[model samples]
Target: MKEGYVIRDQSLPHFLTVTIVDWVDVFSRKSYRDCVIECFEYCIKNKGMTVYSYVIMSNHIHMIVQSNEGKLSDLIRDFKKFTSKTILEKIQSEPESRREWMLERFKLATESHSRNKNFQFWQLGNHAEEIYSEKFMWSKIDYIHFNPVRAGIVSNPQDYIYSSASNYIDLKGIIDVEIVQIPVVNVLKSSSVVKYNSYEK
Candidate 1:
């Protein structure tokens, strides 16, 4: 961990962004991104992680998340450890065009730090911001959703399959998310809202 980047309150939800080392486009391929999706699913189902929203881009990922066990930091650590090893293995086993270059970069990153024994996949420190209010939460969610759009990958956020936007719009997503349920004050004749069942509702 880095100074001032440690998780202080594990109970609160956080907006976290994790980038690849050296900004490598490791997730440009489906297999690499699938590894991330698998990790997210495994963590959510078994590691007590609660993911409200997420987006997987070419070289990074953004998520709105916490942990049911109040061990968000531990969950992140485990997820990164497992994914780094798995992704590195895949890069070695699979026919990757940039295998040598990518492996060299990861090896360099690992050598630069004493914590790693072989390679470093994710960059140090998750840029995490604690979510305090509904407004801030929505802002972070929108920012996460529009990342691909801002990068010109897609025009509509919902069109991006590797994001929570489809899940929010009631589409079957790559991974299930625990949507936050905001309290509703009133309902008009022609207007109603969907409510989600989860801990942080």
Candidate 2:
């Protein structure tokens, strides 16, 4: 992992991206996406995680999160480990049309890494970029909310149910998030914007 992507300050909130191995569309299924939401809810309730903003795409997830317990790295590690196991099990047991294909891909992904026993669901590293300034924080939140729009999945950010964009717009989201109470003007004035595709760490 690159040094910039490393979670240097575990106590502060960071913009995090966890991509699927080989960019597989594991989360294209609603069941798989629900598993991720359940995991996030569990983390928030039991693991001291505070999700400020988030968006769940087909192959990856982005979030602005911090740990009240000041153990962001550990929280993320456990979240990934649990989600990887649970989602893999679901793919095998649930009514997935691409079960065999997905399983084979996951199996092949583990061949190079001896640490994995059967499969590798998530790709290594969280691509964590610490939120250093207010402008950067809002920029990441904007980037996250607009992901589905950029993909042509939804015309409006709040129309995406799997994202916290709805929460920002005052509608009840699928999962609870710690809404940042910044003025709309501040979000618009955040000049140092971080583009989604331009992120390389």
Candidate 3:
């Protein structure tokens, strides 16, 4: 992993990107995407995870998250491990059109790493960038929300059902998130620095 991508502060919010092996579009299916949502819910309920914002793309996920227990690394490790096993099992058992193709890609990915016993679903390293400033935090959130739009998936960020952009727009999302309150002033456009306000419960 690169030096800048390391999660030095586990308790602070960080912008994280977790991609699938070979960037396979495994999450294009609703079942697979729901699997991810279930895992996130479990983490939040049991692992002390505090998700500010998130977006699930075709082959990757972006999250602005922190850990109440200050164990972000462990939370991430467990999340990937459990989700990998569960999703792989689902692919094998469920009626998937791309079952063999996806399984082959996952199996081939394990060739480079001896850690994986059968398949490597998620690629290594979260590419974590700690949210050091409010501006940086909001920028990542915008980047995450606009991903689908940039990919031409949706015209509006909130229209994407799998993203927390809906929550920010006063709509209920697939999962609950700690909504970060944007400053009253238009700090994003200002040249001066600004601090993050408290989150809305």
lDDT of 2 by residue, 87-133 (tens): 99898887999899989999998888778989998888898999998
Ranking by TM-score: 3, 2, 1
Ranked by lDDT from best down, the candidates are: 2, 3, 1
TM-score for candidate 3, please give it: 0.91
Q: Write the per-residue lDDT of candidate 3 for residues 1-201, one digit (tens) a residue.
A: 333578888889899999999999999999889999999999999999999999999999999989999989999999899888999999999999899999899999888888997999999999999899977888788788778989999877788999998888755889999987775586665432221211122
Candidate with the larger lDDT of 1 and 3: 3
Candidate 1 per-residue lDDT over residues 1-201, each given as its tens digit: 454666789878899988999999999999999999999999989999989999999999999999899988888889888888999999999899999999999999987788888888899988878998876786777788778889999877777889997787655689999876543554232121321211111
Which lDDT value does model 2 have at 102? 89
Error of 3 at 164 (Å): 0.2
lDDT of 2 at 174: 94
Error of 1 at 91 (Å): 0.3
Highest TM-score: give the candidate number.
3
Clashing pairs in 3: none
Give the distance in Å from residue 83's predicted Cα in candidate 1 to where it truly belongs: 0.8
lDDT of each: 0.83, 0.87, 0.86
Error of 3 at 182 (Å): 1.2
Candidate 1: where is the Cα deviation over 4 Å? 182-201
